[model samples]
Target: MVVFNAPFDITLINAELRRHDLGSLEERLGAETAPVIDPLVLDHSLDRYRRGKRTLSAMTSVYGVTLQEDAHTAQVDVSMMLGVLQEMAVRYPRIAGVDDGALHQFQVEEHRKWADNFGSWLASKGRVDDISRAWPQE
Candidate 1:
């Protein structure tokens, strides 16, 4: 599965499924979620020093993707996100070269590192925010 923010979307999906007594995505797949690509996570990890927002719209602009005017719609957003991923892979060969399993694991660790660093930065500013380290789930 390819998603802009896999953690948020997958967690929401699992929540809704649990509300209805349906199995979570991982359960339905009968294994740990693998081969899921999150463009937002990839872009954040790969371009760590890039300035400005990492919103889907911001990424589209960064990657030269033509975002449709009605981009908040699911179909349009997904298309734009895929375009961003393609451009990311082209610009960063490691993204394209890595296997899916490894890529997923990489994102997990990268998210953890990001969360820790961001949390520390927030604390330095005297903010008491809790950033989650969970990836592709929470």
Candidate 2:
């Protein structure tokens, strides 16, 4: 499990958008098996500066994460957050990073890992190559 910690609320919003893509465990994993991995808030130290009544600089505070559950414990992985960074880089370059290629690669890797594990699990349960097989291909 990889957890994504953001420096502020805006970043938390960014994280939520990312969750919409990779961690969409609604169908294959089943609602019971999947934890409600949503945007979260927490108390953390922040280094904020005032700029004409607006807060600026390191907005370290609440963050969100996607988690994986085992028989007993849960885990967080930072890799899950790479998608958020990708989305942010489209508009706000500062949210993720300055490098576009790095972000794209991160997203691809994240998707492959997530799909491999989750898809295999779904297939093991005799769900794969079932409903989708009947659909027409273009």
Instruction: Compare the candidates by lDDT and give the number of the best one.
Output: 1
Mind giving the per-residue lDDT tens digits that candidate 2 earns over 1-138? 113322233245445645786342233344422111111111111112222321111111112223233211322233334333333335344423434344433433443444466577788888872222110111
Model 1 quality (TM-score) = 0.93
Clashes of each: 0, 9
- In model 1, which residue pairs have backbone atoms overlapping below 3 Å? none
lDDT of 2: 0.30
Query: Per-residue lDDT tens digits of candidate 1, residues 23-134?
Result: 8988888887777889988888999999999999989999999978998999999899989999999999977999888998899998888889999999999998588888
Lowest lDDT block of 10, candidate 1 = 129-138
Alpha-carbon local distance difference test for all models = 0.89, 0.30
Quote model 2's TM-score.
Answer: 0.27
For every model shown, what is its TM-score relative to the native structure? 0.93, 0.27
- Which 10 consecutive positions of candidate 2 have the poorest summed lDDT? 38-47
